[model samples]
Every structure is written in C-alpha cells, then in structure tokens.
Target: MHTTYLRDLYHLHWPKVILVMLLLSVTVQEAVSQGQGYRRKHLEFYDDKPIHYGILFAMPFTRYAIKHNEQFMTGDTAYSIKSPTKAAFRMGFTVNAFLNERFDLRTTPSVSLYEREVRYSYPSSPEKIDKRESTWIEVPLLVKYKSQRRVNNRMYMIAGITMAIETNVRRGRGGGVGTLDTKSTDFTLDYGVGFEQFFEFFKFAPELRFSHGLGNVFQPSQNSLGKGIGRLSTHTVTLYLNFE
Candidate 1:
C-alpha cells in the first residue's frame, strides 16, 4: 500500500506540481542572468500607467475535502472513502488598477470546466465512483504587492477573495442510487506568489496560487451514498501564466 501511494504521489497525482517546480526553477535562473546584465529595461514606464490589461492562462488541480457523518460509522456498505486531485484548465482576462509603486488591485474573470470525483470502497464489491462535472464563472479580486524591479524581473505576492457561480452542472448517480450534489455558489480565500519577467512587448509572470473554500458545499442526501458525507469543501492549487 505504501509503495502504491508513492507511485501515485509522483506519477499520477502530482504531475502539475512537478511541472510547476521545474518551470519555476528554469525561469528563476533565467531571470537571475537577465538581471545581472546591464541591459536596458524594456517597459521602463509600463508601471506609470494607472491601469493595465492582460490575459491569464492556468492549470488548476482541485479536490474535495470530505468529512464523515454518523452514518459512515454506523453503516456497513461503504468501508472507506477517498478523494483524488483532478486537473483542469482555465482561460481568463486580467484587469489591473495601480494603487502605488508597490501595490496593484487586479481582477481575473474566467470560465472553468471541472471534473471532480469521490471514491467509495465496499466491503465485498468493486470500488464505486461518484463524479461531478460542472462549469463555473469566477471572478477573483486580488491585491498584488510588487518588489522593486531589477533590470527586468520582479517578484510579487497576491492575496484576495474569489466568487464562483456554478453553471451547466451535470450530476450523475452512483450505482443507480442517490447522487451527490453541491451548492450553486462558492466563496474562497486566495493567496499566492509569482515572479515577473519583462519583455520587449509584454510582461510575463508565473504564479502559484492556493484557494480554500470558506463554506460547505455538500447538499443533503436522498440515499446512503451521500448520507455518509458530512462536509465538502473545495481546495484548489493552480499554476498561472499571466501576460500583459
């Protein structure tokens, strides 16, 4: 079991994390070399503007943090439950308002498609899967703190809140039984850090962000499948590439 866990940890579950770390390493090394050079800064006055616009591209790894209800302990059908991380893509536009030399307020509005799942293991039967597919329209209001630029690279940290509304949700039944359902709305606290690399035409930043849902998303169950679940909250880790 331990070996299997290790295999999944590196090979199945954390590919995005590995990719992000590798990219961050390469980008940081490149930034160090560029900063050491006495080259002219490309967008020397880009920050002088009060407002700016950009596009966002990201890969989000999401999962549900589950808590068991009384039924889970009293029942005999399902012996265990597990939730795994699933990867999804997002595309959005960034609208940024400059507040000072060190701070900027930004909003990124995007539509995301998600496939999140929960697993149930039976005493003597095959493992069952409950999958939820949904589309969300999200707007994140964030405040960014920027470090002074060196040559063309800068570091920034962002923290804020995100409001998400569910749309086009397709809920499916597990084993012809009751289905799992969630609320139509979600609120999360978001925080992250990034490195900025300035170019001749645009500024690029690679950011890693974390989001934790503030409210329970679980809906009351009509059958035993969902009755054993007490709370369900969203957790997402995302790697974003921003271009301005």
Candidate 2:
C-alpha cells in the first residue's frame, strides 16, 4: 500500500521529473562529446565577469519533522499522530558575486506557497486532518564552491542559511476542533549540489538541495491538538532551475 501511494504521487509529478532528467541527460552528453573537440565552448569569458545575475524556478517537497512528547505514550490510546509531505513551487531572483576563481557568494530571495497536513487517527472517533497553508518570503545567503570548469560544464556545491517569514498562517479545521499554531518566522540551513551548463546566450544550472529547520516552529496553545504534538520543524528537498 505504501509503495502504491508513492507511485501515484510520482505519477502526479511526472512532468517535472521528466524535465529534470532530460536536462541532466543533455548536459552529460554535451560534456562527453566536447572531449572530441567537435564543438567550441560557449560563454568562454562568462565567469571572468565580477558579477552575474539570474532568476530561478524551483519545486520543493516539504514536510514536518515531528518530535513526540511523553504524553504520546501515556495519553489516550485512541490518539496517534501522522504528518505527510507535500510539493510546492518557488520562484526567485539570484545574485552572484565572484569572490575568486572557484568560489562565489550568492543570495536568492524567493516566495514559497505550500500546504502541510497533520493527521490524528482514533479508533473510537473519526480521523482528523489539520491542514496548514502558508505563504513565505525567504532569503538565502549561500557560498558556492565550484570545481574546475571542463569545456562548458562544471559541478558545484552550495551551503547556506535561509531566513523565512510566514505571511499567511491560516489553519483549516477538518474533523478536528482545535487550531495548530506556528511561528511567524523560521530559519533553516541548506546545502546542495548542482551541474552548470554554459551556453552561448546564458548559463543553466540544475541543482538538488536539502533544507532543515534550525528552530522549532510549533507554537503551543490551549488546544488539545497543540498539546499532543511536542515539536515540529520544517524539512524540505528542492529541485532548482537557474538561468544566468
């Protein structure tokens, strides 16, 4: 059943997955064929510039990393907690400042829209699902380390910290009577690896990044539902497409 559910989820996002795979395949082929010296390199002097600018579009799958309190074991046997992940979209602007030949400082400001659900299952009662929708404005400061450029392709890694402010914190009560409150702001540490492919007109980078919240986002309230959950933190995996 778990496998079937995961398969269905993948099918729902097959278009995005296929597009990423195609980009990767094309980049690899271009890199390999360049060794035969059949094609001239594009943007040969692109990196020599002191500053570069670009825009990025990303798809992120986000979830909550839940920590349970002692009440979970001693509380009502009918209560259980389950959190599920959901996919979302983000668009941003990227500014890169060349610090050296192989290192760069980058800042990306983006807005994210996503939804998350926390479900409570009860044997004697109907299941309850609490849905939280948020709109976040996030700014990430990253340091990118690049390998030596080979022909028109290069590989790089980036690590950074992001500060995000939640603009909307609406909660929907579904089969549950209480509200789940979250903090207005959150901080996260992020890291990722990417391949950069340079073309005549621009540079294209496809990256896979992971982010973990540094602080607990759960805001305790008087509600029983809030008391049941001990701590909640954000976790995300993002696929990014950047054009420079």
Candidate 3:
C-alpha cells in the first residue's frame, strides 16, 4: 500500500517538483566568499539596453465583406444583393520603445485607401452605375510581446486599441453633390504577429506584420443615408525600417 501511494504521489507531483527546482536554480545562486565579503547572484537575469524611440512603416494586405449593402452609397441596387472582391491599401508610421528585450510599446498613425465597384441596374431606366472609394487616417497604440530575444532580433506578437480620425473621403462620383458629408471618426481594436530583425547600424529593424480593424469605419446615420449600413473594417500588412 505504501509503495502504491508513493508511485501515485510521484505521478501527481513530479512535474511540479521539477518546476520549483528549476525556478529556484535560475533565480538564486549560493553566495561566494571573495576576500572580505560574500556576494549572491541571479543566474537567469540579463538586462538589455533601452530602446530610445523609433519609427515604423507598415503596409497591410486587406479585404472586405459589405454587410447591409443596400443601405450604402452604392449606385447599383444589384450590388446590395451580391458581394465583390477587392483589396484595400494602407500606410503607417509609429513611435515605439522597448521596455525590455521581451516587451515593447508603440503608437502608430496611419492612412488608408479603399475602393469598391459594383454594377447597379435601375428598374425603370436602363442604366448601370459606375465606381466608389473611401479613405481614412487612423492612430493606434499597441503593446507587444517578444517570444524570444537574441542579440539583435526577436519574434513578437502585438495587441491593442486605436482611435482614428477620418478625412478626405470620396464616395462614388457625385457622392457629395449637396448637403451630404462623408467624413467620420472611429475607434478600433488591432491585433497582429510579426518578426523583427535589428541591425547594429542606426538600430534599423526590418519587420513584417499585419493589422486588423475591429470597428466600422463610418458614422451612424440619422436617415436612409446610413441606416442598416454595417461598418467596414480595414487591414494592413507592411515592412518596417526602425530607428532608436
């Protein structure tokens, strides 16, 4: 019975015992007598230099799903019934800092351009509608985790929230004919994963990453203008050259 209990205890508690031993070994070291006094050290502690501040440029590969299409500024009624294939483009710049080798923080301000086209057929008139486009400027704050840190490189993942202000919007031709405005503000959540390779000269890092927008990019409408019109989120993929 005692032998069976010992075996069962080993099965249940061996992993925890090993982990505790490993952690203690990493964080504590025996004191050594050096001439006059004894000094203790932590074996797994290493401090890297600070990341002063830097710039990041990004590009996003993006696509969209037009929900509640009938309520949008589309010229074609048929487009409200069907979805189309198109990719949007975005560019961004950020100021970032590394709290340590394994953690970082960044605030990025970006501009994005989007275009969607659909053919609309009028019931009474035999005519088809042409083109439409939208653009916005957004800013995001992100916190990142570097999975592993080497001499000059690290692989990381980032997640954060953003506040975006919109400007210079053009929706279809004759979209802003009279008393209609197409500008708005949006708050969104962003998430992504990427790799960063840093070089010694000027602290430049070449990185590849993706950013996804989680909220609609349009303002709430009071009438038929934006009723039932779902928010169109955006995405971005880019390579960055950083300096700190």
Which numbered prediction scores highest in TM-score against the true structure? 1
Rank order (by TM-score, best first): 1, 2, 3
* Preferred candidate (TM-score higher): 1 or 3: 1
TM-scores of all predicted structures = 0.88, 0.86, 0.55
Please name the candidate that would achieve the greatest lDDT relative to the true structure: 1
Candidate achieving higher TM-score, 1 or 2? 1
Write candidate 1's Cα lDDT for 119-185 as tens digits: 8877689888888888899999999999888777788899999999988755543324646777879
Q: Give per-residue CA lDDT, model 2, range 87-147, as digits (tens).
A: 8999999999999988999998999988877777777888787777878999999999999
The candidate, 1 or 2, that scores higher on lDDT is: 1
On a 0 to 100 scale, what is the lDDT of residue 46 in model 2? 86
Write down the lDDT of every candidate, Cα atoms only: 0.83, 0.82, 0.50
lDDT of 3: 0.50
Tell me how many residue pairs clash in candidate 3: 6
> Residues 1-244, candidate 3, lDDT per residue (tens digit)?
0022354345334334443553443233211123325333222233254444555554344343335654444532332322233445666666667687677787767777755443333346543423446677777788988776444334567788877765764444234322112336666566655544444344544444455556665444442333434655544444444444
Residue 85 Cα positional deviation in candidate 3, in Å, after optimal superposition: 5.6
Which pairs of residues have clashing backbones in candidate 2?
none
Score candidate 2 by TM-score against the native.
Answer: 0.86
